[model samples]
Target chain A: MGLLSKKDAKLITDPLADNNPVTIQVLGICSALAITAELEASIVMAIAVLFVLALGNVVISLMRNIIPSKIRIIVQLIVVATLVIIVDLVLKAFAYELSKTLSVFVGLIITNCIIMGRFEAFALANTPGKAFLDGIGNAAGYGLILVIVGFFRELLGSGTLLGMQVLGDPIEKTGVYAFGYENNGFMLLAPMALITLGIIIWVQRSRNEALIEDH
Target chain B: MEKRTDKNSYTIIFATVMVIIVGSMLAFLATYLKPQIDENKRLEKQQNILYALGINDNDEKSVVFISTKDVAEKFDKYIVKQIIIQGDKVTEDDNAYLLDLKKEHAQAKDKGHQRRLPLFIGEKDGEKFYIIPMLGKGLWDAVWGYVALDKNLVVEGIFFDHKGETPGLGANINQRFFMDDFKGEHILDGTTFKGITVAKGNADPKNERKEDFKVDAIAGATITGDGLTAMIKKDLRMYMPYLQTLNK
Candidate 1:
């Protein structure tokens, strides 16, 4: 009952909606722009970040009591970096092609502000159980936005999802559709990712008045 | 207990222990995963080589696509000879497969140094082709490729890859449209080596000399294109002695 308590449930579900990390907190926007051009890369990035965030939160929370306040940031960084390196190594071993496609972004997860932000803002003050839930909640929030943006970007820019042809490629197959749908090349660029985020933010804020900032 | 936890000495001790643990974990993971990583790299290299030799079947009607399982067998079937050439001398070294072209090129650039260049000789449908591996610096990072030339020194096929390049601009070097343009371009001009030029959208098809040596560069990726051209010329020049001997 303690594990499934209403408060514990709120800690997990809050970030997925009203307290969304990307839309509300506006954390981890850099990776969202860089890797969302393709759905597969975006998904991999999300999973990598999720793994780092969850483990980092748990590790930090477990050590929060003994950690000297003066060196807390350094401790958090070490944990996050170690987790990132482990994720990078696992990806290289199990999913080499995707790992290559990800390249430095997986390594760059150490620099992602969301992981550090959680350690400082939540994990440091919370119990390990609550911190773990918060970590997962924030990661899901970030991952949801990434997958949504990636879905649109891949669908429009490449006429594919996860490299599978969803729409008939006009360049490859002519007369497959009544009206040829040329891929929107602009959608592949970084600017489109920003636009996609803006749209998500807009829809999210409209749906939940709580997300709007008070003037 | 509270006083002990806040002390500088305590922090140092905790930090030291944490670092040791983290360091060993990373070292262990890297060592354990090295084999799989190396295998993936080997298979990827084989696939790239087979692709450059134009043996990688993409036709859906035939076999759908060349899977990872098929790359090793296909590579062995097509690549009949592995020759190492160093300044007019050819050595039959199966270790050519293991040669790091980038490292060899760097050593060659040093004073009073000789580099052994690996050349893969492939036979497809009774016609033989020479495959030369190339390495170069792109705008951001390393760019590498394989060039396969027919007996006449005309480009048969090419496969380009990059470590880190601007996507949609420089990274398009790997695309079929860019590699396809190299086909039929002559790598030699009347016994003199004239490496393929990646012209900046100004390649003149009407001019016989330009047509023979030049291919259209990727628009908006001039640096990568230039790097590719320079890489092709520099690497191919090293193997010119072998090529010339074959001509004789």
Candidate 2:
């Protein structure tokens, strides 16, 4: 309870649902659409974002007082960029193939609205502990959407899950649709990702009427 | 403290310090990780070379996929010679592996200079294969690959890769389905250097000669396909001087 009071726990949990970065805030949609084609890529991207966000939040929060208000945005950017570079380097060193697959998206994490938005809105005002939790929570929310989208995309688009052929042989290989199931090529495109996100928003808003915006 | 935090001078000083700290931190990380990154790149390059040669665990019948650890060892064992060719002459001065194709191509294009091209000679099961490195511009960024040729200058196999091509379209060049089309395509037609062409659709029907000089291009990736075609033709043409010597 001391480590995470009820208020602190909300900082971590609220973003997972109500204040979700991808669904509610509509932040980090670019990467969410781009890397969610495959489950493996989505998971790698999620972890990378999680690492950058949490560390960036804590670093910026610690320096909040010392950072001049006029140049605060620049300071936040520097911190985020540094963390992103570190993540990029570590990924290149250890997970070379996945890093290559993710390509420029990882480096572009510095520009992701969610990280910058949090630095401005939460980390600058909050304590380091709260900022850290908020960062993790928001990134988890983003990751949840990515994984869900990736699951459907990989399964429907390629008849595979995480590169494993769960739906027997591909139509091309089998020369006929296996089990009368054909890959939905539409799911592989970016527009389909937007549609998937819209569906998610619809489901969330319907389940929780508070999420619906009043006209 | 409040006065200092509000002052422009303090902001400048803070920014300078932060930049220095971040710069040094990045520099330190880059330097520390260089060896490991380089090792990974080396292994990947080896794997690509092996893949281009169509010598994998499946061919060797050991494993379904060749592990990264085994790539370097396999490369060393299979790749028998490293040849550097410059304008009809085999140069022993430069190491083939060290020849950066991108840089060399840039220098050649910008300054009208000629540079040595690297040709890797690989041997497997009593057959000799010639592997040529290719570099060209894609729609968005650089695309590159290795093409392995048999004794008659016919494509034995290929391994294409891109830097920043569009996903599901141009980036599909990395897929085996695309690269496999290059196999058995002739780069040289009886001393006539007619590099392979990535035809619009299924080249099998349109190709009158049936000489394996044309392969089908990916739909909706016309630019990338054109880039690949141009890359292969241009790069392979540069090797003609060396390839001519091989015929002699």
Candidate 3:
């Protein structure tokens, strides 16, 4: 309360659950489906988006007054692309192995609609400070869902959490495999991610009746 | 009421200026960091080649390469000779590892040009190994690897990497289980070059039959596995003429 007013703090707290980017707004679903097959990749991508979105929101907000309305989308895109390239280059030079793991995601990050969505919807009219808070909140919200989906996908599909075998080895017949429990191979596929996300959306809405809509 | 940013003239000028600034900044950073990036890639190549030749820090599961600070010295200590073979012409070149396989593979289609195959020979514990680099297409991007074989042309060990395969599926080609299965597999059946296949219906799942010319495929990675199989067959076949002369 000392640092931010109630309204300002809500900007940060709102997206964690009720206004979540993934479940509520339904943005950035492509990446959630693509990389959530493993818990580790999901965490890495979430961090990458956190860095890009927070900084991008600030940059766009600072230039909000001067940016031409006609070319605003292009301007927003350039900011995202430039930041991603810088991140990619730095990682390549220093953290080579980590960079290789993130190579596929560099392109994915550029096209993520969440970044564009915030830039156009919030940053275009907000102050840099508020925009930064909004970015963190939304990115955190998106990351929260990604981790949940990834946790189940990796655990059920591969019987492992972050590459560590939790369930028994299927080949060696140890742990749960001794009990005739098999990993669900379908959970690893992209379609399964959609179903998982759907389940999350349903659970989230049912708990908070405000999120439900009557047609 | 029309605003300043809404004007077409201002929009065009803003775009032009933004493009120039972003373009130059990127160009400068890319150029400035090229040396470090290239050095990292160079060390990775040495580590991968050494890993195939069985010089690594791996335990039972994870694939760990030698530290970058020590890779150069270890590379020099283990690799005794580097050579390039083209058609019938063979030449010893210390920098043969720097040769771009993608370019060489492309040039192979030209009228009279032959692809230059770079192979590294390493000696450890008084045993000689022939290490060959292979390049191929993965499900998403380029898949490349190093294969080390003994004088009898039996696979000693292998390493696989990719530019951008699917994270948990196709990307597991680099994982230990998949790469480890490739060990002891034969690239030759009798006197013929019968390269190994990444078989989904592998009869001997434990890979106990080394002479069967097969390794178990990752469950959801059919295309990547097939690409790897074709790569081994295509790339290793070109080096057969030189490899066959080894026993003689």
CA deviation > 4 Å runs, candidate 1: A1-3, A91-98, A164-167, A172-182, B1-4, B57-74, B165-230
What TM-score, to 2 decimal places, does chain A of model 3 have? 0.97
Candidate 3's displacement at residue B68, Å, is 0.7
| Per-model CA lDDT versus the true structure | 0.82, 0.81, 0.94
Count of clashes, each model: 0, 0, 0
Model 3 iRMS: 0.9
Instruction: For residue A69, give model 1's deviation from the true position in Å.
Output: 2.1
True contacts kept of each: 0.38, 0.53, 0.68
Q: Compared to the true structure, candidate 1 yields what TM-score? A: 0.83
lDDT at A4 for candidate 3? Answer: 92
Scanning candidate 2 chain B in windows of ten residues, the lowest lDDT window is: B57-66
Model 3, C-alpha of B1: deviation from truth (Å): 2.3
In DockQ, how does model 3 score against the reference complex?
Answer: 0.78
lDDT of 2 at B19: 87
Q: In angstroms, how far off is A116's CA in candidate 1?
A: 1.7
Which residue segments of model 2 deviate by more than 4 Å? Answer: A1-4, A94-98, A172-182, B1-4, B58-73, B110-112, B166-172, B188-194, B197-223
The candidate that wins on lDDT is 3
